[model samples]
Target: AFDPPRLSKRADYSGQMGGVSEGEDVLARWSDGLLYLGNVRRVDSIKQCCLVRFEDNSEFWVLRKDIHSCYHPECHTPPIEPEVDPNSWICRQCVFAVATKRGGALKRGRFARLMQIMKVRLPYQLSSLDWDPQHLTNQQQCYCYCAGPGEWNLKMLQCGSCGQWFHEACTQCLTKPLLYGDRFYQFQCSVCTNGPETIQRLPMTWVDLAHLVLYHLSLCCKRKYFDFDHEIMSFANENWESLLLGTLSDTPRQDRCQNLLNALNSHKDRFVSGKEIKKKKCLFGLQVRAPPPLSSDQSPFIAEQPINITHRRRSETGAHQDLLISTLNSVLGTESIQTPLNFSLFVILQPFAKWLFDLKGNGTRKALIMPILQPDAVT
Candidate 1:
């Protein structure tokens, strides 16, 4: 609703003027009485200049003294309203609605960040940097590819984060159209472009730091345990994934590690799912369940760790102890699940077998339990 005053008469006085520029530092003189000014400050009080062209393509400059309200060139409808009273421009109702919807005016720190994100660059450099989008308002526009399919005007675009606009080309990949998804827009920047050479070219930003933190947590879960004992040694033996995701090891502080460990431990119950088998029970003492069949591809070996064996005689009666051994031995196939019994081996492997069951989860655990038996060749 910007309304400029109607010009009563033209003034001959040419005072020194400073205004926003399209490109060059000098003001372009139009055929009509208009002087296309440059470097104008972005102030609400100083309104946009409207240049009216004559029959021969000459123009006359109309300052705030010549216009009442702006109309869309096509629709002729005023989309924005003017400030009725600057002294008390906002009413209580409007102020409350704005506050309620926007969650309050943005803080200056966030405001500056938004401005920086939306800044764009020109293909060619100019002497004065005043023409940059960083200094313009949302309504500002620069010349676009005049000969392109669509005669476009590169408008000052504002970022959703910072409410600032830059040339569209400067901020996005020009090779393809952007794809917008449900929550956020997905567009490849210089950092996300594919190819080994391109990947090498990527400049690290805050986004890279955020991704590193998430990836580190993921690998820790896969390894079953988070190990940071020897950083130098570990890095030497680390894989490609570790190198790409190894920012955490550089820091001396280990305070945040507990939080990562706690998260993994908390989710352990949800991680594994399997059946607990029941075995033959005696009158005096209870027998534990049989070992469940391993999922396909899983090995009886939970992992490559050393087998830690400990035995305790909770009951004095020989019958109770013998029963426990009998059940555990049977699980280890010592009693020859089908052929012959090997009692000593069963006792030795029982403890490690129990630990393997504890780590079972989804397909990985199921696959782990199943042994990778090799087929025997016919003689």
Candidate 2:
């Protein structure tokens, strides 16, 4: 039987082991890229094997030739004195990862240990930390609006409401990156968090307003009033041109006035206001104005308001006047114009009246005069 090489008995074997003793910290290079820093638990000189335990509580046995003293004078700065507890060792990679992941300053003990080991200065400014392998594997993949799937990039943000992930490019949120010190947790998508409905509802440009006016005029001509759909078609058919022209042209000076009139006359009983006709109903409750009398000077002067017509009733007058004023202020850009009651009423009601006349001819449509008011529209 062969005898074991005992360090106490054989001085040559002790010299060959490179001074790595039991219960001492060591750096072991197991492969070209893999390196482990651990405490030497046991030394088996008979088998030329050494048992080591790492910070992550993993143990391995390696040949004595692979292990180096943790404080090797040539490789690292020699410690002032040997550490009292060999178990208080931590790797440089783990120290940095822990500091970054916690988003806080490094621990005092770990910092002092790191200073002793590293010849170069530690870069504390680095933001990203290596995620724990087990934690990374357990995390759910992020899904972007474009259907891309992966872990969140630095530029990706999560919506607190929907639990969805979106890229900064997709969200148009090109704001600065959130700092660790900000302590912000909640985030919301644009649609989920409500804003002014008027922003989406209000017309953006003059062309948009023109389109809305034309749509509402067309609806009136079609007798598609929500409350009373049954009405005389003569009123709409007769005065369709005047109504269409007045409503469409803000100043009523466009050459297209005659063209629109001709179009309305040609269509007669069948009027198509396009696909989105339902949304045009908001302005339909406006009081119609009677056509202006022929101007003697031919300068297109404002119309004179009619007086004491038997058709004008006392109960409906107040409501109609209120509706007319609000419509002129909100829709027709007439908020600043101050005038007598007759002139103001004439200016406001003339376009609507012409449209209503085209819908019902000589007889007035009660439905056209009295509209179902929206709650917010009043006052």
Candidate 3:
């Protein structure tokens, strides 16, 4: 099995960073690219990952490269102030799920915890054509200077501000290391680092509705799907005029208002919305049902060949699947996916009840479980 490249320069066989003692304390990086309080419970020597149990009593395996420390176990001197918010503690997995589900529509509260993840010692000058979905949001390893598939072996660094990925070699970095392996630094890309003359820097304290949408949508596109509904509702809750003005507001690209729906229609492979319609006997009596949420080809195994696995079952890579289910179940505040109750799960996932209820009439087990995997089709 292949492993992803970790930024760890000196990870060790022992659980903690640099072989700090077992059951020791450490900071763990979540999907949104920020560190939070967690402690080392055990180590997966084979995967070179650690079983990190966070302060909230949630436990999962964090890649060794994603683990670090500010003041404990490791000997280090403070250069800059500790960056992560003391009050920013929340369910890290929940943050990951919400961010992924909404395509990174982070509300101001959840958005406040954003901090520096890694610095691009070198910057990639992107062409006007470089801003497409393929280059920016689609890849696992981003914020870097390449178009290559994510290589676990490569030493990679990600820009904390814009979330652009960088290959260590491209950074031309010799000095100015992470200094403390804390997984942090005030890093920006060429576009961001070049100063406000080149682009407006998103304020660290208060990011308005306009900036949140544009910044997350335009830059740091780790999550591709932007929740326009969330953006508008958020603006509407505050001020409707701001909603309209915010969409038309200036962006680093100096983009025109063509981004309203055109950009979304083009960038996202699909859009999903559920609505209940009442029919009062139409003139033609035509079936008024909406199109199938997923095409048969996409939502396969409802009746046929299976991926040969279930949410409970795993294959050669099943452990990872198990880990995901466990993490999501924990993050979602659910007991098990086998019992996907609406109140117990995240609101975004509430629709699963209806879908699964309908699916139950068909085949059982894997056949029912398979279609639920296509998130693109489901969402």
Candidate 4:
């Protein structure tokens, strides 16, 4: 068998030309029958390479040893420069040119594949949008600006700009938890804080206040659904009307009234008492039964095991009472009041509490009534 020709050594190019000079014409043979005719734009002895600008205006880095002096009769004369605008240089071999010729869809597909292989995101889009669904599903939760889903342990601040919740650890700009006082405060996210505006403030609305209160209440009661029956609706409506008229006759009445109005308007959908029933019950008393209370196995929202009734009852008169009072104080921005406990409010909320706790009628009384009477809960 015949052997292939041995590759020439680097010393073979010595004395071929004085040296690879910048702006000097040369022919670079990268491989057999594959030659590049270009001018040496730069020579780097340290890198053992030369920056060659080809006839097509594109440039490449070729080893100095690979360059040979061109002495072709026509090569001796400098090639006429194309009469293009001096400011505008064109390179048909560039990435932009290749993408333009291949069309947008193919370019995008290739880019997407490359991003997938590299586990990276496109710079222009939100990181959240590019997250893998499987990762989100496996993790079950996510925090602000995190590319992957995760459970955030720290107290989160809601960004006024994006309305997304972010933990302090995730943001370099977030300094502290929002301070609660007699008045509302605005909070902006890390991104918005450094943006054009010095500070982006979120406006406080009655609806927003109500939503916050309701969300807290839902968490406390461990309930996802709430049905506002007739009694609750009447109590809310009465307080709302009293507030609007500025005639609510109770201590801290004005503040309480405003909070009541906010709560009522915010949860109007839950007040289903007034909706007329279209279908009448049959003479045999057929009725649609309410669904069973959520089982622990069904959702993470529900407790895995039943809470001890005795322990709950004791706490109802103790800690639970304090919780209710504090909740009312925080929401209404009021001190302790002398008004009698709002029994009607409890009556309205009883069914929901019963459903959530999976309590019977007697259990509902112990669970709800005791707590209200323990302290002057809410006026």
Top candidate (TM-score): 3
Q: How close is candidate 4 to the true structure, as a TM-score?
A: 0.24
What TM-score would each prediction reach against the true structure? 0.15, 0.17, 0.34, 0.24
TM-score of 3: 0.34
Give the runs in model 3 whose Cα sits over 4 Å from its true position: 1-16, 70-133, 136-377
lDDT of 1 by residue, 1-379 (tens): 2221111123211221233233223333221112233332222233445454434455444342222221232211111236345464333212212221111122235432332222222111122122221122211222211000111112111222222222332232222211110011222222122211011111222222222332333333322122232331243234323232245435343533443334323332112111112321110110111121112111122211121111122232233334434544343445533212132233233333334434432223334433421111100
lDDT per residue for candidate 4 within 183-271, as digits (tens), equals 12234543444331122223333433333333333433444233333222334344443222223323263465455444454443322
Q: What number of clashing residue pairs does each candidate have, in the order they appear?
A: 27, 16, 9, 0
Worst 10 residues of 1 by lDDT: 144-153
RMSD of each: 28.5, 33.2, 17.7, 27.6
Whole-model alpha-carbon lDDT for candidate 4: 0.35
Number of the top candidate by lDDT? Answer: 2
Better candidate number, 2 or 4, judged by TM-score: 4
Lowest lDDT 10-residue stretch of candidate 4 = 281-290
Better structure of 1 and 3 per lDDT: 3
